[model samples]
Target: MESFPTELGVLTCLMLLAASLWIPYIVGVNTAPAGSLPADAPDGFIRIPNPALHRPWVQRAWRAHLNLLEQGIPFAILVLLVDRVDGFTALTYWTAIAFFWLRVAHAIGYITGFARLPLRPLIFLGGWLCCLIMGYAVFAARMV
Candidate 1:
């Protein structure tokens, strides 16, 4: 059996994390009060109120998911770029793992309201920095 690369494993974990972040928001929406037609509805149209507004946790969950998307996309791209260029290095490997865990912490903190003020932003910054480090590794590797 062939062993998978560590970075690839981290990438898979990150993707799974993104996939699961929507659960809380969806559950919150389903349990919230029923919605109604919009004020500007012209016919038999109906629109649900923004689910995020139904609860603070739901709102945080929604925002956390959004933040992941914003950060995850670039991280994914950079990871792939590194892989494509055979740019795997100690720095990239460690940073990839760090990025995945940081995202998990960020999501949990946001959804549960555990991390606040500077803490959440700092977690986000860590993930962003991981992406930058991976990107730089890719660039440096390609220059060789």
Candidate 2:
């Protein structure tokens, strides 16, 4: 079989990660104290107006998941756009791979409240830079 682009593979993993990141958030919520949610709450019910009410870890999980989605959506678009225009390059491959790992680390750091000040943000910034690199590469491909 022909080899597919590595960036697409990384994108697949990122997509799966984003889809499943909610697991920890939901688990944290369900295991929280009573009165967190209505007993007869419907499926897909999420009504937490005051996130402060939940455990700190739960809040982190929610935020981590949200951050993943925030980054994942844009990353997916850029990767697909680059691939669509046949803009595959060594830089794209490496950045896509780095972005995936950076996101994983970011999620762990966020959920565990590890290094909230500097390290965590730096990790996030790394992933953001990866996206920027891919975006720039795609734009540059148009000039070639």
User: lDDT values of the candidates?
Assistant: 0.84, 0.87
Once superposed on the true structure, which residue ranges of model 2 sit more than 4 Å away at CA?
34-50
C-alpha-based local distance difference test score of model 1: 0.84
Clashes per candidate, residues 3 or more apart or on different chains: 0, 0
lDDT of 2 by residue, 1-144 (tens): 978999999999999999999898878876767666656756655545344557788889989999999988999999999988889999998999899999999999999998488998899899889989989989988888
Query: Cα miss at 52, model 1 (Å)?
Result: 4.5
Per-candidate TM vs. native?
A: 0.86, 0.87
Give the Cα-based TM-score of candidate 2 against the true structure. 0.87
lDDT per residue, candidate 1, 5-72, as tens digits? 78988998898989889888877756655453235644432125364346688778889898999999
TM-score between model 1 and native = 0.86
Name the regions of candidate 1 deviating beyond 4 angstroms. Answer: 1-3, 33-49
